[model samples]
Target chain A: MINPINIGSIDDIDEGEAKVIPSDETGTGEDIAVFHAEDGNFYALNDNCTHETASLADGWIEGTEVECPIHAAKFCLKKGTALCMPATQDARTHKVEVSGNDLLLYPNVPAEPVEA
Target chain B: MSDCTSHTSEANASIGRMSRPEAFTQNIDVSTLVDSDGGLIDRSIYTETSIYAQEQRRIFARSWLFLAHTSQFKKPGDFFTTFMGEDPIIVTMDKTKTIRAYLNSCRHRGVRLCRADAGATKMFTCTYHGWSFDLAGALQSVPNEKAYPEDFDRKQWGLIEVPNVQSYKGLIFGNWDKDAQSLEENLGDMRYYMDAMLDRDPEGTEVMGGVMKWTLEGNWKLAAEQFATDWYHVNMSHASALMVLSPTGRGPKAEIAATPGRQFGSENGHGAGFPTHPKSRFDARPVHEYYDYEALRERLGDAAVEGPMTTGHATVFPNFSYLPVNGSIRVWHPKGPDKMEVWAWVLVDKSMPDEVKDAQRLYNLRTFGPSGIFEADDGENWSEIQAISHGFVTNNVPLNFQMGIGSERNDGTYPGQTSELYSDAAGRAFYRHWSKQMNTPAWHERTEQA
Candidate 1:
């Protein structure tokens, strides 16, 4: 089970834009990037680009896809699917919903560390 | 009595600092530097000044070093100035096109004879005095000859020549050791990879207009090892460079996924890496479209041009390194334990069109040149790591190279010891060879042990 945490109001982000919110969820201290898609929906994903330690929110957004600013690896903003050579692993996605003009995030719990 | 004091004093003082061997207080202990399986090495190897001095003697002095490309010295009187470790050298070709190298120092007063980076000239006249030497490094003229004995032999005063100078394909290398192995023998399995670039076109390769030089606060081995064996970093470090260089950030996902590649390590510390599949070349961007792939394929076939041969890079031990994709050749000149002077050049096929050559040169500059985006990204990590080493906490920090410790094995698919690209087996092999060289006092004893 997971709890939804209030991120911010819808007025904070522009339509079809993304912003990163720092969190200590899963104790990783990694940031969670939230997107306000042009599709009239909000989405959330891990801020760190799976390919490297770059903020995906700082990347260029075209429709529902975001391009990493550091290396331009495109990720599907809807599903967090890595769409290029350098990034093979899919970025971890999160669940988001809106309540009373406020955005709520339920970040996917990180997988347990596998022991060798 | 002559009124002039010793003319050699100032020049001798300069040469003395350059030539004097660093005194060692005690034998360096490399035992902790390298781990048992050769999978881990101490970060101190990159930061310790004493260890760098040992490497200068044990590793650099005994190795054949890349000096210049043969195309640079096309005719008689064509000459270039470079370095063998820290010692300056002048490479020239005589009337017969015979390549020769001499210590850049003048015999009379030890002044550097050739100051220009490169040019063509019949003789190099030292600026400190009017001393001059012929193209073949023969003493030609001296100023005020009455200062010495009548029996003073000018023949014995020619520029000090390096004992060994050789070339493979168009690459010229020099060595101070008379007993050092031939460049080809030293290159060994690495030659197969080098030929992918050298033998790509029937016309051979030539260095582009000028060399790019820059300084970075980092150890030379860090750059050399990364070029040789660190493909794992590409997924993370150069992620942005790949997206920018490719066609609108659309790369051949099929090729990248199909052939992840393998890394190769040899006994002599040479390292190479390339994809296992021949049809899986990594240059899928539109920027690379101008490359005459059809001609390259026809000349070298798919196996040599389509696989790691076309996409990979290698180092000829110590410091010389080059890439096949961009044709960038460089030597990581050690300035100190924590500093390196990078002298880089772009090599292109002689048959390439002017426009294509220009495009290639620009692409090389954008990708690997000093101000290149990718180069800046790499420098950030290297310089940061070097700075971090100054902290006392770094003494306890054991850097890990154990990416694929026990997985290294020989396979028919590639030459020498092969491992998956995800592994640091090549880095481990490098330290294994480095430890052996640093522990041995001389090249002869190292060979004798073998």
Candidate 2:
């Protein structure tokens, strides 16, 4: 089952920048970083850096990449690639949608197979 | 002539102004060790300073000390920094993929070359004078090539190589003494135990994650002796973890209460304190539930489950210690007379399931890391031993090692060696060997006789 989270209104942001808002309303344990690219597309990724377990929500978003403030391991906002040493794993990417004035996010759960 | 008088005289004499060499000489004295009843007190070997110094030279310097596993250097120009005794050295795999180790100091002014914990580099440029060396440890470039006359050859100014750098079963060891015994000869019977732990899997064992390096406030010998034969300390030292893990504290107690299988002291100083069966603290869980347990059992067959873990732990002479439970290898590298840096790596068969490897890593961290419960108890006692031993009066007195005296009888059970699977005399034997080398007049004499 996929639950849609209404983050913000479409007119609330401009192109080529991201508006990171608190995920407390969604009731999910994880906080998310919302990105609005220049191509009129929206993307969502887990706000935490996978390497040193740092919060990436406070990091700087430059072009398509978000640089983690702690160790500077960069992650692409569009495609989740942890492009640095230290962080060998990829960040969790979520599906984002915009309908009318509402910016929504579809949370994706990790697909680790349950042990018997 | 009387036993009481002889014992009193020996004890009194040992307390007097005995030089380091004299104390070391007394170690190999089998008669002085044997009690009136002939049982051996192995603890004496654990407490002596002369024997410890001798071990620094003979065992640590001469023998092949495990530096790192081969996988740490996977790519060309990949290098990792580690220490062999007090000397810092770097191990690198060149563009040709040949592994080599050299002193980490720059050839110019001895400044450290590789500052990062680990990374891939085309060349190591010194931070001081900008002197650089490449993967082959060759003097690659200098700022001014003709600064020195034609008499100065760049080839002669390469980083100093550790005399012996060799790997057996994927574990690499380095030695300072060029004339020392080969790695194979030094491993001796210990290789059998290593095979059971490492070679059981077809693809062999690979270090699952990064290593944990930490400092423990104890003499290196104290840590080494714990691995040698100190199973008796488990119930008391690790009572907290054992209480949590075991069905009851009485489970291992019930098994070992009657007659604990004796400690097997191997010819080349490898020691194993064998238990009768595979005793586990895991409550009613399937043996294979621990992940690598079943795969390892399947690989080594009866030996993996029934032999190594259940039977005993093997302390490979000087430094390496292996515990088969979830497969952990600990290498205790001595920093000095009283300080040691512990490097622990979790060993998993290459073919193990990912989930199992994850579990093993977690288990190893919880039990063995700096904050680990088991290591916490051990660190407390080890530090206290070092602290009290520094006292003036306490330092002069000898620590007691008079356990299992007169009970040791060398019966021909395991062939080709003097086998005594009866006592903690293994510790005593270690000290004896240690003292013998320390007291020997010259390194050449020790090498010649050895």
Candidate 3:
């Protein structure tokens, strides 16, 4: 069953940044990174760095790239292409929906999903 | 110079035949190598100085050593620095999407060209003299162009190109010997096994993240041999994990106490030693239960999965080897005769679920990382073996490798390779090949012999 839960309010943040939403009663797993893109759209990717397994929440968010703190491998938060070396694989991306003031995330996507 | 030439010619006369006294002394008893009872050599070959040097020239230089996976350099200007043996190299993808590797040292002042872990840049400017090189390894500019003569050709001053660089199934390998066999020819039968691991998914496999690099105090061959066939050590080395995972009194101790051990050796010096019913009789309760054994069996096929899942290793000759059930690829990059940097990568099937990959990565870290339980035990033993072998007395003494000697029979499966899946002498064959390369004349002569 897919349980939709309220994570955070949209008015709390500015543009081109993210918020870590903790897995609550209706969430799937641990904290998920919810990003507010420059285009005014919110997206969520796995908060873990695909390189050294560091936390992406602590990484520097520049434009569309999140540079891992440990190895500095950049990841395109929207498409999840590990932009540099060290990280040869993409991070798992989650579906994010802004329902009124509540930020809803679906962590059902696999870490490395295979496309049919 | 005259004396050196004479020595060279004399060495050339004995090409393709073992003549070096050190080769015989360092390897198994010379009589046993040719005779039927050759598989008895233990971990001694892995530590021998003469053998290691020979491998550097024959196997490592000639054979294709894995550099980096292609996924690391997907962008035009992206680059990563790695080593081809002890030589520093920079791998880059150009605007044309073609991958190229060049010596990392600057041609002008011999400074390391690339220092960053990885990045995209139109040109790499040497921090020392301000010389710059494009992605294609061409020297683009010099700080003081007037300092050189008008006849100076910037084209001639490009970064030294490695002799051969190629990729097969996303895995890239670089070779130093220009006239050596192609990467395809060198891989040979090992390609089949690699295919089974890599080519399963249509999109092919990608390096999960960055490579895990660590140094272990042992000869490179020790790392290779352990991944090749040291399953016997696991029962004792990893006894704590086994005991914890095993149900009550059901473990390797009980199983070995009950029945004679079962071991299977493969052709071309690849083999494993463990009980026949590894899954049923062994203590794999923790890992086996958690992992999707059914999916593994279905994906790897019945024969690949039927082996001792708990304990087994396959050495693919020269440098690379892995234990599939263990979920790791071990590469022993040679630093020197006594030291090697062990590069281990956790391999997961592209088709596996995300949670499974995460679980496998965690399991791999706990089992094989620098601080891993199993690696800690193995590292101590490897270091001790190297220290002991350095002794004048211990070095001369012939290490016993006489297990399952004459019992091995030719299965007629692999050509130019022998199979003895149940013997300890499989390691002896590895050394035999080692001695053959070490004792043979230089590459020119060996090529002529081939």
User: Which candidate comes out best when scored by TM-score?
Assistant: 1
For model 2, how does the per-residue alpha-carbon lDDT over B257-286 read when each residue is reduced to its tens digit? Answer: 333455655545566655444553331233
Q: Give candidates' CA RMSD values in order.
A: 28.2, 17.0, 16.0
What TM-score would each prediction reach against the true structure?
A: 0.71, 0.66, 0.65
DockQ of 2: 0.02
Over 4 Å off in model 3, which ranges? A1-116, B1-55, B253-300, B308-311, B407-422, B441-450
* lDDT digits (tens) for residues B130-185 of candidate 1: 57677777776565567879898887677777767778878888776666677778
Per-residue lDDT for A21-61 in model 3, tens only? 66563256666777776667776777766654455765667
| Per-candidate fnat, comma-separated | 0.00, 0.00, 0.00
Write model 3 residue lDDT over B257-372, tens digit each, in one string.
Answer: 34333343333444444334444333223444555657656775654444434445666566676655545776777887778787777776566667666776777787776877
Using TM-score as the measure, name the better of candidate 2 and candidate 3: 2
- Lowest summed-lDDT stretch of 10 residues in model 3 chain B? B1-10
Cand. 2 Cα-lDDT? 0.64
Model 1 residue B218 CA deviation (Å) reads 0.3
Model 1 DockQ (Cα-based): 0.00
Best candidate, lDDT: 1
Ranking by TM-score: 1, 2, 3
Cα lDDT, model 1, residue B315? 80
